[model samples]
Target: MISNLNEPDFIFLLKSGDTSAYQQLITVYKKTVYNTCLNLLQNSEDAEDICQEVFVTVFQSIHQFKGESKLTTWVYRIAVTKSLDYVRMKKRKKRFGFMRSIFSEESNEPIYDRPNFIHPGVLLENKERTEILFRAIDQLPENQKTAFVLNKLEQLSYVEVAEVMEVTVSSVESLLFRAKQNLKKILGDYYKENEK
Candidate 1:
């Protein structure tokens, strides 16, 4: 019954467990959250899993939202945090697996497994370039990567990114600047190596 309400009202309904409110919230945010997860994790399955976790966390913790930022900003923050957590956990597992393989007699694990991610919306003509770009983005430092994803890929404003990241607008600007510089160096090195 809460169709056209503002965010505060929508949140009120959600906190009270209104079914429509929950539906509306998911309908409005599912793709954004999923994309955020996918861009960070670079794997659809992990993204989907983390997307569900983000929603669950949101539902469970709605009462903790202090209204300091826009509802969407808070949601984005949750999505980013969950996605990064998944990435960190995956890296830990990979490192542990590597160590175990070193000690095992018959271990045949690959040295590195890069994620094969093609954003569903990318044009066919740009798939190769997109893949390269994604790989470069993946190599970025975590903060720079998060800022880049939210600003460049998700098209959020610097102010909005700062809100989501809980940083100042200037910090967001700096992160984006560093992300771009790093991406250029990465892509340049890749192309140079390939041209050899």
Candidate 2:
């Protein structure tokens, strides 16, 4: 479908409206797309939907491909935009019922996996604390949280992140610096309070 797809083949296929080539594109990049969406949304269903939408958008816009960047980078830029927009929309929806929302619900996380050396019981004991940490991450301003996750968890280079985030490399560095500082303060306070 994509023929060679090392670079030139992809440009030709995409520009020629070869739908089969799009299928190959999705197959090759599906896991990365799904996982990146999951990292942003924190919900499986949302991630799945967003991944599908991303592929659709990419295919529809393929004719506009200007070769300004590599295909992968172009697709990733779309993924980042869709994901950030989803977060903002969700934030707006939650703003009205925000307080009751937090106190009235129990988290629905199941299927915990632990290290082999650790007992299941011990793992459960730590699970709530881990949930708290994730909640703190969720509470972070979205941009800072995005930087932290992409840089720390996904291991993207600052330059790669800059392209995805549509910013300069120095801006990415500053964003991550502030994110790290804020996370340390928030997480450290949580631990100190628990210790006391």
Candidate 3:
């Protein structure tokens, strides 16, 4: 059904409030959007929630989508933006929770608990390594993490990543370079601590 609908037509229908077209769009891009969210978020539940939120946002804002870039690129940009927002919110909540604990009569709880994030698509043998990698990725600055996930995990070209990120390809390259360096340092420290 998606293959039968060309990009321009699909955009037209979506903007005109065609329900079938919207459903088709969701069906066609759901997995890609979900995976993109999951790779950034690590938690399956949060990713799933954000995936729906992305579509809702796009649907509500479809009229604002000028035809400058491919629809997929625009959608990727939305997914990345929404995912980063969610991460920032979580961090803020964690900090707020700590502050509340300091002022409250209740005992202090563990402020940072690493979530058990098992990416559904990962193979059994690679799951452990992937989890460790995700932990390190979570610590990265937002731009580096976004670049790394979109370029390496989602297999998007640097050009595509740049378009989605609204940055130059050189900037994407720099982000990936820094992301790799940071990940190596983080994973190295993690291993050293675990080995002792």
The C-alpha RMSD of each candidate to the native structure, in angstroms, is 1.8, 6.8, 1.7
| Model 3, span 1-196: residue lDDT tens | 3668788888999999999988988998999999999998888889999999999999999999998999999999999999999989988988988887898888556676448677788899999988888888889999999999999999999999999999999999999999999999999999999996
Candidate 1 residue runs with Cα over 4 Å from true position = 108-112
lDDT for position 141 in model 1: 99
lDDT of each: 0.90, 0.74, 0.91
Backbone clashes counted, model 2: 0
Q: Best by lDDT, which number?
A: 3
Error of 2 at 196 (Å): 4.8
lDDT of residue 18 for candidate 1:
84
Off by over 4 Å in 3: 108-114
Q: What C-alpha lDDT does candidate 2 achieve relative to the native structure? A: 0.74
Model 1 TM-score relative to the real fold: 0.94
Which candidate has the top score in TM-score?
1
Per-residue C-alpha lDDT of model 1 across residues 94-192, encoded as one tens digit per residue: 898889889988798765554577877899999999999998999999999999999998999999999899899999999999999999999999999
